[model samples]
Target: MADNQFSLLSKRRFAPFFATQALGAFNDNVFRNALVILIAFGVAGLSSQQINTWSNVAAGLFILPFFLFSANAGQWAEKFEKSRSIRYIKLLEIAIMCAAAIGFYFKSLPVLVGVLFLMGTQSALFGPIKYSILPQQLKPEELVGGNGLVSGGTFLMILLGTLLGGALMAHPGLGTTWVSVAVLVIAVSGYLASRHIPLAPASNPDLKLNWNPFTETVRILGFLRGNRAVLNSVLGVSWFWFFGSMFLAQLPNYTREYLGGGAQVAPLVLALFSIGIGLGSMLCEKLSGRRVEIGLVPLGAIGLTVFGLDLYFARPEAATVTGLTAMEFLRAPGSLRIVADLLLIGLFGGFYIVPLLSLIQTRAPRDRLSRIIAANNILNAVFMVTAAVLALVLFAAGLTIPQVLLVTAILNALVATYIFSLVPEFLMRFISWLLVSALYRIRVQGTDRVPDEGPAVVVCNHVSYMDALIVMGCVKRPVRFVMYHRIFKIPVMSWIFRTARCIPIAPAKEDPELMERAFAEIEAALANGELIGLFPEGALTRDGEIAAFRSGIERIIAARPVPVVPMALRGMWESMWSRRGSGVGRMRLPRRFRARVELVADEPMSPSEVTAATLEARVRGLRGDAA
Candidate 1:
C-alpha cells in the first residue's frame, strides 16, 4: 500500500482507475461544451432567446437520464464485476461519440442534443460504479485521500475539457471537424484506460436485478435510509451539488452583468475556482491525518457560507465600465477580493464534499453501497434541477444575480444547520477535532492493530483530561470512552462527550450504582460489536508516571470475554490540560503551545491471556520515556 494519496497515483490499483475516470469526465465536458458552442455560434437563423432556450434544453436533456436510469445502473453495478462494467460503459461511450461525430459532421442540432442525452445515460451508469469501487480498492485510512484525488481530478478535467472544446469550436471553418475528432480520440482513450483497470469483483454477485426504474428507485432509497448517518451524508453530498450547480449556472451571467467582463473573464474565474478545489482536495489528507474525519465537514460548511456571503458583498453593483477583458477585469478595483472569495468557496466546497463521500462509502453496506450512491445521484439531479428552477423564480421576482447568490448562501447556512442538527455527530466531531488539532500535533502509530470491526476493549494510560480527545482524533474507529463522571461533566466538553456516547463512570466507593450502570453499558456495547475505550489506571495521573492498572478492567472482561487492545498516549503530561503545571488537582497553560503528542497501539490480546497488570506493562512499554 502507498504511504500517501499521491503515491497511490503511481501504483497499479489506483492509477488506471483514476485515468479512466478522468478521461471520461474530460470527454463528457468536451462533448457538452462543443454542442453548446455549436448551438450558440455555429447554427444560423437563431435569435439570442432561441439560443438560450436551446441551452436550457440541453441541460435538461442531459440530466433527464439520471432520473430515468440511475436505479437500474445501481443494480448493474452491484450485480456485475465493476471493471467489466466499466469497460462496457466505456464502449457505450465510444458508440455515443460516434453518433456525436456524425451529428457534428452534419451540423444537426437535434442529433447532437440526442447524443448529449445518451452521454448523460452513460454518465448515470458510471456514477454508481465510480464511487462504490473506491472502498473495494482502498483501505479505510486511504479513503479520504482517495476521495480527495477523485473529486479534484474530476473538476480539473472538467475545466480542461471545457477550455479545449470551446477553443476548438472557436475556429472559423474546421471547428466541427476538430470537435468530432477530439471526441472520438478522447472516447477511445477512455476505453483503453478502462482496459487497464484491475478486476473488482461484484459486491452482490447474486443480487436479483431490478429492471423497473420507478420501483427500484424507491427500494434503493430505502436502502440508503437504512443507515441514518449514511443517508445524511448522501443528502449532504447532494446539497453540495445543488449549491455548486447554482453558482456555476450563474457565473457567466454574473461575470457579464455584474463584473462587466467579456467571455474570457468567466473562464478565468472558473479556472481559479477549479484550481482551488484541486488544492483543497489535495489538502484533505494532511488536514485529516488521512482518515475519513468527517469533523472537517462542519469546518467546510463554515467556510462555504462565510466566503459565499463575502462574494456578494465584494461586488454588489454592476461595473460602470462595460466589456472589460479578462486581464483588465483582474486589474479592476475589488477584483482580487472577488477572486479570493470564489477560490475559497471552491476550496471549502472541496473540504465539505470529500468527507461526505468517504463517509457514505465507509458506512453504507458493502452489498448495497452502489444502490445508495445511485440514490445520491438521483437526488443530485433533482436538486440541480431545483436549483435552476429556483434561480428562474428568483429572477422573475426581479432579484439581481448578486442578490440571488446572497439568498443561496443564506439557504446554505440554514440547510447545513438543519443537517447538523439531525446528526449532532458531525458537529461533535468537528469540535473535538478543532480542539485537539489546535492543542497538539498528533502522531498515531499501530492503529491498524485495532480491529476494523467486531467488539473489542481498548485500554490506555490515564495522562490528561484531553486523553480521550487525542485518542479519538487519532483512531479511525469511534471509541466510546469510559471517563470519570467529573471529567465527563466539564462544561462545553460535556456536550461533546455526551453526544459521542462516552460512558460516564463513578468510583465504586463514591457511587456504586453509577459504576454498576457503567459496567452494564460496557457489556451491552461489547455484545453489540462496538469498541469500548478505557483508562485502566482509572483516573488522571497525579504524576507523569504510569499508575497501577485498576481491577475494574478485569471485572468488565470477566463479564464479556473479548479481545483487549493495549494503547498508550505519550507527551500529553506537559500539555495545558494535564496536571503537570499546577498539581494533581488542577491544570495550567502549557509552557509550549501545540505540543507534540503520540498515541501508540499494540496488537490485540485474547481474553485468556489478558490481565490488568499485563496490559499496564504493555502500555507502559509503548509509552516508554515520552512522558
Candidate 2:
C-alpha cells in the first residue's frame, strides 16, 4: 500500500473511499445549494418578512446540530468500525433526501428548515468519522496525496452540486422532484459504494463517553490541552473555516455590488474560487512528494496574503450590467486579476490547510482523536459563527462587500501573526530556511521520488529538534512532527510546535496514556491525508551519530499504509547545536547567526517489507560520513 501509488489509485480500498467522500460532498452541497437558491430567488416571490423569518430559522437549524450532536458523533467515530459507521450514515441520507422532497413539494419553509437542521445533524455526525477514518485506510506517504485528492474531489463535488442544484431548481416541474430523486440516487450509490469499503478498526476500545455537549466539550478541550500542537492546529483549521465562511457567504453582494453582476454571477464567483482551491489542493500532492512538509504553511500563508491583497486591489469601481460568461469575466475591468487572485488564493489555501489537517490526524493521541476532532468541530463552529457576526458588523457599518473582504484579508494577516508568533516552530522553520539560503546551498536528489501529497511517515536520524524544523523548511508540504511531549511544552517554542501541529509523545515508562494518544494522533493525521514526521532514533544524537532506531515509527506505518520517506541531514548536526553534553536538554539557548544546514531526501521506501528494523538500517546507511 505504501509506495504502490498506482495500486492505491487502482484498488477497491481507495476507490470506495473516494466515491463515499465525493458522494457526501455532492449531497451536502446539493441540498445546501438548493436552499440558497430558494432563499435568494424563490424568497422574493414571497413576503419580505416571511423570507427573513424563514431564512433566520433555516440558518439556526443548520448550525445548531454542531453544538448539539457533534460530540456524540465524534464519540461514535472513536468507538466503532469507521466503515460500518459511514454505511449507516449513508442510509440516513436517503431519509433526509425524502424529507427534502417533502419540503420542496409543499414548499414548506418549516419542513425545509427542519430538513436543513437534520442535514446539518447528518453532516455533524459524518465530520468526525470522515476525518478519523483516513489514517486507517491509507499509507503514511499517501496521506498528503490522499488529502489532496479528497480536498480536490470535495470542491469539485461542491461545484457539481451547485451546478446541478441550479439546473434542477430552474425547471419548475423538475426542480424539486429531480433534486430529491438525484439526492436519493447519490445517497443510494454512496451506500452501495460504502458497503465495499474495507473495515477500519477503532483505535480506542475501552473508551468512555460523554454524550452531553457541555461536559463533552470540556473533555474535548482537556484532550487538546495535553498537546499544544493539537490545540493550535485546531485553531488554524477553525480560522480557515471562519475566514473562508465569511468570504464564501458574501459572494452574492460581492458579485452584485463589486463585480457589477447579479445572482448568476454569484455562483460563477464561487465556481472560480472553488476551482482555484481544487487546483491548489491537487498541486500540494504534486509539490510535496507525499510527506507532510511544514514549509507549505509559510507558503500557504504567503499565498493567502498575496492573493487576498491582490483581490482587494483587483476590484473594479462599479458593477457590470451584463452577466458575462466565464471567459468574458476575464475581459471585464480588473476581472482577470480578480479571478487570478481568487484562484491563487484557493491554491495556497489548500497548501495551508491540508498539512495542518494531516498534522492533527498524525499527532493526536489515537484514543482521544475522535474527541479531538469533536473539539475541532466545536471550535470550527464557534469560529464560523463569529465570522458571521463579524461580517454583520462590518456590513452594518456601511462597508461595501469588497471593503469587507479587504478587511478580512487584513485580519488574516493579524490572525496568522498571532498563530505563528504563538507557535515558533513555523518561525523556526523560517529561520532554518534563511540559514540554508544564506550560508549553505541545498541540492536535493531523488526529490521526484517522494510522493507529492498524502500521509507519510518520514524517518530520519535525529540530531536536533531543529532536525524536524529543518526538514519542514526544505520539504514542500506541512508535516506533523512526532516529538517528546516535554519539548512540546517549551515556552514560545511550544507555541511554534503547537501551531505547526506537532504531535507530542511521552516515553512508555513516563506516561503510557500519552504514548497511546501520540499513536492515535498519528492515525488521525494519516486519516486526514496529512504527513507525520518522525525521528526513528527517538532522540537527538548524543555523540553526533544516529542513535538506535525505535519501533514506534514502524507501528505507526503499519497502522496507516503511507510511505516511509527517509531523508539525510548532511550538515545540520555539525553546525549549530550539536553540543556533546549541554545542548540536547538546554532551553532558551540561542545559536544566533552561525549555523549552516542541508537536508537531502533519499528514495521512498514502501511499508510492505520495510519493517522498523529495515527502515532504521536504511536511515543509518544514509547517515554515512555525515557525523
Candidate 3:
C-alpha cells in the first residue's frame, strides 16, 4: 500500500476527490485538445490557419473567466459547504458538457468555444473550493502527501485527458453522434465522482461575504496580509504560473514548426511535459519525508534552471526532421533528448510548485485560507494572461518558436536569481543544506514541543553565526537572533542576517553604546511579544567547552518573562567555525557543511524556573553525548 500510487486512489476520502478532480481536468483538456487539433489539422475541412486562430482564441476564452469570476468563486467556497458546492459545480460541468456536445454535433466552432468559456467558468468556481477544502479534511502530516497526490493526479489527468480528447476527435467515427456520446459519458462520470466526496463544511461559516470584485480584491489582499508566509506563498504561486504558462502556451507551436512534426504532434509533446510534472510531484512526498520542506524551493529553482537550459540546447536544428508520428519521433535520437529534456522541465515544475501550494495551505490562517486561495487564482489568471500576450508578441517579433522557448528559459534564470537574491533565506538554506549533508544529521524532535503561537525567549550557548543559522534552519517559526554586532557586520552574511532582523549585540566593555541599543531593541522586540533568541555563552567555545553564560540572558528573561526554551549547541563545537584557537578567528567560515553540528531545543522553562546555572545544566544535559 505504501509503495503503490493506486493505494491513495482506493481510499474513499481521496478517491472520489481524485476522480472529481481528474474528471474536471480531463473535460478541460478534452475540449481544449479537440479545439487545438481542430485548428492545427483542419478538422471539418476548415483551413489550417483558420483553425489555428480559433484555437488560440479558445485558449484566451478559457483563461478569461478567471479574471472576471475568481473573486465570486472564492466567496462561494468560504460561504458554503464545499461538498455541496462541489456537487453544484459538477452539475454545472454536466451542463457545459451538454453544450459542448451541441457544438460538436453541429461542427459549430463558436458554440464549442463558448462551451469552453463556460467550462473555464465552471473550473474557476471550483478553483477556490478545490484547494480550500483540502486542509480541512487532512491531517497535518498528511497535508504534504495529500497535496502531492492532488498535484500529481491533476497533471497526470491533464496528460490522459489530452490523449483522450485528441483520440476521440481524431477517430474516423467521431462524427457528431460519437462526440456527443463521449461528452455525456464524461459528464455523468464526473457527476458520479462528485457524489462520493465526503462532506466538507464551510470554514468561515459566519463570515460576511463580499461580492464586488474591486472591494473584494482589496479585502482578499488585506486578509492575505494577515499572514506573511501565506502572502509570500501566493506570490510564489503566481510566479510559477507566470513561469509555466510561458512554456505550455508555446509548446504546440514549437512542436509543429520547430520540431517539424506539425499539428498532430502537439499533444504528444504536451503529454510528455505534463507527465514530467506529475512524476516530480509524485516524488515530493518521499523527498520531503512527508514534511512541507521549504528547502525544496531552491532545489526546484535549480532544477528549473538546469533542465530549462538543456531543453533549449535539445531542440533539433530545423532541417533533418521533417515530420513524424509519436513513435517515429521517439525513435529518432534527437527527439528522445528533447523528450527527456521536456520531462525534466515538468519534473522541476512539480518540484517548484507543489511545496508552494502546501506552504500556503499550512501557513495561511484557517479563517482566511479560502480568500487567499481566491487571490492566488486571480494572480495565476493574470500571470497566464501576461504569458499569452508575451508569447504572441515574441512570436510576432519574428522569433521562431524555439527561440521563444530559449528566451523564456533565460528569463526564468534571471527571475530566479532576483527572487533568491531578494530573499537570502533561500541561500541561507543552502548553507544549512550543506551542513546537514556533511553531518551525522540529527533529527529535530518535539519542535512543536516548543510553542505554536506565542513569544519565546530561547537561550543557548553561542558558537558561531552558523549557530543562529542552524537554529533558524531547524525551527519552523522564524526566530529573531541577538547576533554579536561584529558578526552581524560580516559582508555577505551581514545583509542576510540583518534582513532576518537579527538583533546585533556588542559587548559592554568593547562598545557600551551598541550594547545599550541592543538591549533596548531586545526589550522592544520582546515587549511586542516576538520571539527573542540570544546565546548567553557570548562567544564560541575556545576549546570545545561551554563558556559561563552572561547575565544579559538573565536580564532579558526577567524583563520579558516569556517561556524560555533552553537550547544546546552540540558538536558545532567541532564545526570548522568553532575550531578557531582564538575566541574569534578567520579559520572557520561557513563551509558547504562543517565537519558536524546540531542545534537542539530542550524543554521550555518559566521565567521563575530559569537561572544561569539551570539554563547551563539543561543545555548540557540536552547536548548529551556532545557534552
Candidate 4:
C-alpha cells in the first residue's frame, strides 16, 4: 500500500516539516547565489582580486556559525518543543530576509555578507530540530523513505535556488529587487508551513542550557564516544561531506580546464550530479524495502570508488577539447562516459548518506539526539573545510583535478574498508540480509510483539542450518543467537556468526565449562539490555516435526527472569539446508532458489510463567501445519 516515498507529502505530520525545510534550503541558496552574482558582476569599481577576496570571505563566514553556535542550538531544541522552535527559527528567517532585502537594495557587500552570517546562524539553529524531529514523527519502517524524501527535496531545492537566484539577479528588468522580493516571500512561506508542523515535545525538558558553545561543543562530541554506531555514522557522514565538497569544488575547474567548457558547463554538471543524487535518494527506499538498511553504505562506497576511478580515466586530454557549450560537450566523444560516471557517483552518494543520517536519528539516545546531531553538523563543517584546504594543498603539489579525483577514490576505498572492518556488524548484517533476501522470501508476522528495545529471550523452533540466519535477517533489532558450538564454527557462516556476537554453547556432557560459559555470557548480555535468541529445539529438525524443547531455556530464564518470546519458522524443512533426506549428509545440498519462508512470532510470555513444555507448545502452534 505504501509503495512510493512521495506518498508522505500528503500526510500532515511529514509534509509541513518537509515544506518548511525545503523552503529554508531554497531561500538560503537564493540569497547566497544572488549575493555572489552581485559581487561578481554588479559591484561598481572593485578589482577582480578584491571581489574574489570578498567572495571567499563570504563563503567562510557562512560556515563559521555552524561551528560556533550549534551546541547552543541543540541545547535549546532539547529544552523546548521542536515545532515551536522551528516556528521561531522561521520567524528569524523572515527577519534575516528583510535585512537581506535592504542590503540587496543598497548593493552593499558588507550588509549582504553580514546577512549571510545570520543566514548561517539560522540554519545552524534549525539543524538539530530538523533531524531530531523525524524519529518522533515517522514510524521506524518509514524512516528510510522519510529520509530519502528529505534528502531529495533538499538537493532539488538547492538546484532550483541556484538556477532561479542566478537568473533573477542577472535579469534586465528584475535584478536585486526581484531576488530580494523572492527571498522575503519564500521566508514568509516557510513560516506559514512551519505553523502546520505537529507538536513534538522536548526530548529532555529539564536539560540545562549550556550557552558556552566551546565547552558545550566538546561535551556534545564526548557524548558520541559512548555510542560506537552513532559515532561511526557521524564519521561516515563527515567523510561524505568531505568527498562531496572536494568533487563539487573541482567541477567548475574540471569543466573549464579539462573539458574546455564555459561557465554554463559547470551548472550542467551540477544539474546532472544533483539530479542523480535526488533520484538515488528516492531509490534507496525501494532497494531497502523502506527500512534503514546500512548495507547500502558498503554498496555506496563501492560505487564511489568504481565510478570515481572511471571518471578519472574518462578525463580526455585538454588538447582534444575546445570551448564548448554543455550540450556540445555531451555530444563530444568520451563526454557521455564522464557524465555517466558523475551520475553514478551522485547515485552512490545518495545511497551512502541517507542511511547514515537515518541511522543516527534512529539509534542515538533520544534525550541527547539534538546535541548529537549538533556534533554531526560541527564535524561535517570541519570535514568540508578540511577538504577545501586539502584541494589547495593538492593543487600546490601539482596534482591535476583528475589526479586528485583518483586519489580521493582510492582514499574512499581505504576509509570504507577500515570503517567496515572496525564494525563488522555492518558487513555481517549486509551478508545475512543479502543471503536471506536472495534465497528466501520472508513473511514475518507478529513483528510488533518483539520488544523494540531492552532485553528479551526469543525462543524459536529450529528447522534448518539456515534458521538463525533467517531469524537474524528478519528481526528488526540486533540479536545474539545461542547456537550449537559446531554450527557456530561452520565455514564462512562461522565468521558471520562471530562478527554478529552469537553465543556458542555445548551440552553439559560434552563440555561443562563451555556450557557454563554460554549461560554466563547470555546473562551478561541480558543484563546489558540486549536481545538473546535461542533455538529451544536445540538442533535442526530431522523429520519436519517440532523437536522436544530443551530445559536449558528454563535455567537461562530463571536466572534472569526476562520475557520469553516464541517464534516459529515454517517452509524451511524442505529447503536444502534442512536434513530432510540424509540428515547431516544434506548439509552440502543446494536449496531451491528464493524459497518462500514465513517467520511468525507470538506474544512474549512472562518469565515466571514460561516453561520448556509450554514454550515448545507455543512455538509449535505458531508453526502449525508447516512444521
- List, residue by residue over 93-145, the lDDT tens digit for candidate 3: 88888888888777788898898899889988999878888887765545667
* Candidates in order: C-alpha RMSD to true structure: 2.0, 10.2, 4.5, 2.3
- lDDT tens digits, residues 1-627, model 2? 345344465777687988887998898888877886787576447777777677767777888899888888888889888889999999998889888889888777778888899889988998887777787887666777777778878988988998888788888766778887888898889889899999989888767776677887777777888777678889998988887898888876777767766556677888888988888776775555465555567678777877888887787355646565555666776777787887888888888888788778877876777778888988899898899899889989998777888888888888888988777666566544544445444444444455655667777787765566666655655678899888789776676677678999989999999999999989999998887888877777867777777888768877887888887777655566555556457563454344545566778887786677887777777767766
Q: Across residues 1-627, which tens digit of lDDT does each residue of candidate 4 receive?
A: 355788889998899999999999999998888998899898889899999899889989999999999999999988899999999999999999999999988998999999999999999999999899999998776788999999988988988899889989889856999999999999999999999999999999999887789999999999999989889999999999999889988887788888878767878888888988898898988777666678788888899999999999888455356678878888888889988998999999999999899889877889999999999999999998999899889989998999998889999999999999988878887787676667777766775588877899998988788889877766767789999999999998999999889999998899999999999999999999999999988888878899899899999988899998999998987775777776456354556678888888899999988999999899989999985
Q: TM-score of predicted model 4? A: 0.95
Worst 10 contiguous positions by lDDT, candidate 3? 587-596
TM-score of each: 0.96, 0.74, 0.83, 0.95
- Give residue 514's lDDT in candidate 2 (0 to 100): 95
The 10-residue segment of model 4 with minimum total lDDT is: 583-592
Question: Mind giving the per-residue lDDT tens digits that candidate 1 earns over 1-627?
Answer: 567899989877788999999999999998899998989889989899999888988899999999999999999999999999999999999999999999999999889999999999999999999999999888777888999999999999999999999999999899999999999999999999889888999999999987999999999988876678888998999999999999998998899989998978988988888888887887899899887788999988999899999999999998788788988998999999999999999999999999899888877878988999999999999999999999999999999999999999999999999999999989999999899888888877888788867899998988888898877766766789999999999999999999889999999899999999999999999999889999988888878999999999899889999999999988988876777756533445455579988888999999987888899889999999998
- Using lDDT as the measure, which candidate wins? 1
If both were scored by lDDT, which would come out higher, candidate 2 or candidate 4? 4
Best-first order by lDDT: 1, 4, 2, 3
How big is the RMSD of model 1? 2.0
